[model samples]
Target: MRPVGLALIALAALIPLFWFAPLAASRDPVALFSQYLGTAALIVMGINQFLATRVPGLELVFGPLDRIYVLHKWLGIIAMVGLGLHDIIDADMDGLRGGPLADAAEDIGEVSLYGLLILVLASVITFIPYHLWKWSHRLIGVFFFMGAFHYFFIEKPFANADPLGLYVSAFCILGLVSYVWMSVLRPLAPRGHAYKVASVRHINGLTEVLLEPRGRGLKHVAGQFAFLSVMGGGLTEEHPFTLSAAPRDDRSLRFTIKDLGDYTSRLYRELKVGMEATVSGPYGNFSMPSGRDPQVWIAAGVGITPFLAFAQTLKHRESGPIKLYYCVRERGDIPYVADLQHLAEETGKLELMIVNSLEGVRLTPERIVEDLKGDLRNAHVFFCGPAPLRKTLKNSLVLKGLRASRFHFEEFQMRTGIGLGRLAVWLWDRGIYAIEKRRAEKTQPAE
Candidate 1:
């Protein structure tokens, strides 16, 4: 993420320099810089599409998908700011005011600009239900395609024989294609295998989604996730979930989902055996690194899912002295406790420590540092959990002389909640509790 993000930033910063710097003296400097800003924004938006595509070459090196999301967000913001500056400084309204044709074109451009602003803002708002936002966001394609028309027609270069126009036009075209591929084609894309539901097990308030692949199975490292869109139960949209087990020889995948939203909460009832779904991407870089030092693995709630995959990988490798701190709000929230415990015992050097937050086990970094055999700097610390827990632990550990490089974790933004201010809070809070309903005495075990 660092290298690719920085490169994109650099390119966004440099395009204006390379393209507009030479024309600065010949044209009105203000108008020239305004056009430059618009052009830079267009370039950034083009880059935006590529990043969103989840190309393995880029993501494998540049990101885990979470950081890419944050980066993708910032690029959109930068583009909007640039376009705003362009509109302000290059106000050609006086000319447009005199001509009806010019006025119509100018109005269209204004609409496109504002439309993009709303689209980007909608995405930033965590309160908006992801489903509504996901569908509405598709309208950006219309605005974007029209923007390309606006660009080609209004930019003096393309209509007036400027060579730089070609590149800008190319970017706009590419951006349009990318948006279509992602918004329309991706869900049905053949690269993602079709899977039939093998079983749905509701355990400890979480739904274990086990999928049996219909054809070629997804090849992924442990600790990775994929986007799954079930055809049944009104689940037409693709949602991301982590693979909880190492790739089974039978090629089945498991997702232990806690109801975090409208869709997930009902999945147990709606999704059933023989139902179909599409699986795209084996994304994320949450896997363990090569070296075997005294490793400290920490997990909170459902965040422990990835580490469960990692534990399976440990079976075949030369293992290290590892300590897993699995913390949950309560014991019932724990998923695969027996399996994870078995992995710990089987690994010989790995130990599992279950911390029930309900019972008052505080997982402070200071406590962790003291528990380990050597200096904190020597241990490779990998954490998976809620953002608050990761943040608190990371801050304390880094402050207490742990090398920042030794730490690893993904961003844990709560993104699944549906719609509006305090209502969003109400929905999300209950949505979580609703998923974690205590199982009844009469419920059957996994069949």
Candidate 2:
């Protein structure tokens, strides 16, 4: 899908360039022609922005889509440079440089110098990987408006001067309108629900926060997460955090976070009581089984957060026969240990196994399989942790002849960074393919 989107945008940009090639016999004509191409490029950018936000299920291609996003930024810079050259050749620089202060300002406004400046600034700010960049990028919303204003008000004159220009100008306006609708208005509309923090506690070198919906709502299932936006900060900057509390009728949500990066660290240090948060979620399908089938949840370090939710849900719902193999560096690294213990005591169907790597206690898949040699036959296994740990556990389980369908894992690393638009598009394409394949397989007659 990303390749298709990129190809479409590239075609839009190139079409104007190709149309102008025949007019290169006249320098003035060529300069004017390039301005039209620049306008087309802006329209392409608007289309890219629109598709990125509206599309869903993009995580699968996030790794490659990030490269496309870098290309998108550079393409914008190239368009701005081309427009600058076009203005230099077509418009009178002498007039722009020598006019009165008010005249110069008016000329500047006519050419979208302010819009270009804002675009450049927004692009630079986005390069910063910190949470500040997350907050600052909301200002890019202003750039879309500015670009539309520049297109409709300033370029419209050139557009009206010629039939070809008018056609391009009308299309640009339409694209800009679509971009604004999708990127700004739609996101701000009430779509998802909200949650309030029930409690904030420090455990196992992580901050555990419990949240519940502000009103009547369905509880989240185990292994699902919510996208949380802390108010007082910009609303556009939301991060996904796994739920650490079980699903229940009580209106409490929980998140266990370690101080790893800028956002989580600040969430631990700076979040206060009564801080309003918007939650868009309960996404993911990693849940324990409910029948007589045995299940195992393997977690490492703060990755135990989701497992805690599963355990709690199991305890409260009496959905049982579950085992947890939680590995941590030290006793202090075990998040919600006391809570897990309490839940285990309440639900005799739950077994808690703790492995401390820092205390010279190493756990290999072979050793784990050996410990539960007979128990491995009828169990589903779920794992959430660092890549290396997950890989080891997965290999161990596979060696024990566990079917692939019985293994569940959550990959949250793909959700990091600023290029969600590209990610969303990529995910949408993959999700469509997966759905189609599933439907085909389901409908096929058995051999």
TM-scores for every predicted model: 0.86, 0.57
Model 2, 188-302: lDDT tens per residue? 6875566666677876558877666777654577777767777763333567778777776675677777877777777877676667777766565566666777777788887
lDDT of each: 0.77, 0.63
Instruction: Write the residue-wise lDDT of candidate 1 on 1-447 in tens digits.
Output: 778666765665565466567765655668777777877787788777767787667675567787787787778888889888988897342222232354465677788899998988888777778779877777877777766666655634223245576667777877888888888787556667788889888877788888998997788888888988888678867778888888888788988887878888768568788899888888887778777678899988888888888888887887678889988877454678898778778878678998887898788877798889447877888998877677788888888877888889976652422234667689999987766654443365766
**Where does candidate 1 have its weakest 10-residue lDDT segment?**
91-100
TM-score for candidate 2, please give it. 0.57
Pairs in clash, predicted candidate 2: 57-427, 58-427, 210-253, 210-254, 211-252, 211-253, 211-254, 212-251, 212-253
Best by lDDT: 1
| Candidate 2 ranges beyond 4 A from true positions | 1-182, 233-236, 316-320, 331-333, 374-377, 416-447
